[model samples]
Target: MVWTEILVPVLGGDNDAALLAIAKALAEPFNAAINVVYASPSPISLFSWAGEGGYGPTDVAVAAMQESADRGQARCRDLLASLDYPKTKFEAVTADDWIGLRTVSRLADVVIWERSVSRGHGFLANAFQQILLDERRPAIIADKPTKADGTIAIAWDGGREASRALRRAVPLLRGATKVVILSVPHAMAHPCDGSRAVDYLADQGIKADAVVLHTQGDAGQAILGGVRDLGADILVAGAFGHPRLQRFIFGGTTQLLLDSGSPAALFLSH
Candidate 1:
């Protein structure tokens, strides 16, 4: 399947440009249409107090929220007009409620977002993570400003999540002239033979070589090393792992890969 419709959130920040660029890159390759969304804080519910009476401040706050939404929409429109793609379409909405998620899940074939807006507080990331896990649509997240070119690496771990990510990344996989599937051997995990992985891709008309690395090092480091050695432009892997107790913990491979500066498009799934 091809990604023909992309939903990108236009959060007012410095990273908005990077988000737009990613939308363009992924969309242009497939001739897709982009839907830009803006999110604003929802209006607060008002209540009448027993002693203190008036709702004057509440009314003023609601008006301010409305004004902010209007300004944000205008900025989004100007940004879309300045972009160069003719087929690139635009939509501006104030996601003051869960309607934003519903709109994206229902209308977008793929969601493109950044890791965080300014610091670690990433509204788009939180929104799209739920979308990817629940909506059954692919979400391409730009953790940092990444250049899309060079070799491509797929981290294969023989799990349901990894399989799902691999299936979703078929279009990008087909385009990469040089693809490598790196499987690391863990103590309890059954090692995947390179031949079997290669044969599986061959059936789907994709020819890729596999390399099994038995490294006594961190999985993320090994994967990054492979990327540098192979000159890879992107890395594809599953998003999360089994939760330990009440806290959610990502596998070492996933966490390290996320923190790296290798200039790769990570295709992730849970």
Candidate 2:
């Protein structure tokens, strides 16, 4: 159950390094190919130039985009070449933000992205939230687990999503030194003792402790506190779902986690 391809969608800024850090940490050890995709729409997509000199303006805009893509690819190539890891490789692609990155994500084994953790309805944040909510989206590597051989935590709720996340995170779990299954019964729809999750991991040769939390804040905060208390370097959990309007009014646990400056890597699934 090794990852073959890891997709990393970089939107530039400080996220570039943050995204690469997680991708490298996860991919290097597994010898997986890291695909750093940059979503930069064609320059022509930005404007409406109907009264153009025939097709000259359109051609110019497209050429501009092509050149920009080339330069970006060149930088990636140089960076990868410098690393020169025979097992771990790198590839770069430029595509339309709406469809291309999503397409690539569908085929990837896992995705390591920047947990920007912003408290705004910005485009990037919205796009990332949409991805997290995508049921078809692959397993994600978040908050940057530089290495897998560390304490790992799982937020358990006796739900399908949490179960799926545990399975998806097995590869990394294999290297964990300690596993803590934190069951926050506060706001959970199907609260359990977390013993089943612990037993399941034990069956897979991963010993874990089951801890049911009784907290004052929401379930998300309880999970956060549990992770910090356990000294876990990575967190695995199912992404809880909510109505769109409700999420807009009251954010879901997964959304809040995504927006926090997490101290551990978060592996979440829908």
Candidate 3:
């Protein structure tokens, strides 16, 4: 139930600082290891010459790619050094190294992904999807680092996905100052009271309040409103509880929450 490994992926962009800050905050309480992965494509893949003919690139091209990758890795190391967090490891890998990246992600308790990265394009976005769907691990999407000991709100529906998310967030709930369970009957595909969730948290020594929201609007909007009203720093819920195909095309509550501009971080499990 303890979090020991927190996997964070960065592209050596301006977002690295914010992403690492939150990762460190989540790691401090548990003395967890922050494995910062820096993934970028090799120069060979960027040009067509390597793939056009059955010939490898010249030594000069290979060296140039290696130098670029080294610089990116060095910059990332500098950023981590400036943060002054001791329990951290920086890894450099090609963007196409799915096997290597998954090995790192599978061993992590949770993966921290920047909000913008999820909505972004190309390799990083593909990696995010693979880690969440293929790997089936809990993920936290954040625009900024949330308070480790702040209030938390849970979106409950008495379903397996929500329950799984709850279970994964136990360590965090135990550390929060306050926990609230928000249930919207009209907005749920299978609505149920929040008593069971409240009781479960109670058994875990977490005091929580169950609030039934009577909203006639979209389910995502209702949940977001509740989180804001409660001033919760983080929202815990199941991701893509519905059919993936359906959610992908027409979208669902999960998409809404993901696309929201809310500052609150999301702890999601599928």
How high is each candidate's TM-score?
A: 0.83, 0.84, 0.92
Model 2, span 1-270: residue lDDT tens: 877777776544444665666776787767888777666556665554554645435677778777876776666555545544554444444343556666667767777655553344433554455566662454464655465788989988888888888888887788888888898776766648899988898888888889989887888889999888888898887875556788788778887787767777778777
Question: Which ten-residue region of model 1 has the weakest summed lDDT?
Answer: 42-51
lDDT of 1 by residue, 1-270 (tens): 677787877766666767877788777777888777776655452232323655444677778877876777777777777778767666555454446565666667767766542112655555655666666566676755344444668888787777777887777677777778887776217756456667777887888989877788877787778778887767877765555332244445565666675556666766
Candidate 1 residue runs with Cα over 4 Å from true position: 45-57, 93-99, 117-120, 143-149, 244-252
* Top lDDT prediction, candidate number: 3
Q: Give the better candidate number (2 or 3) by TM-score.
A: 3
Please give the lDDT score at residue 69 for candidate 3: 76
Model 3, position 213, has a per-residue lDDT of 90
Worst 10 residues of 3 by lDDT: 45-54
Candidate order (lDDT) = 3, 2, 1
Return the TM-score for candidate 3, rounded to 2 decimals.
0.92
Task: Name the Cα RMSD for model 2.
Answer: 3.4
Expressed as tens digits, the lDDT of each residue in 129-154 for candidate 3 is 78887887889989788887999999
Regions of model 3 farther than 4 Å from truth: 48-62
For candidate 1, the lDDT comes to: 0.67
Question: Residue 100, candidate 1: how far off, in angstroms?
Answer: 2.7
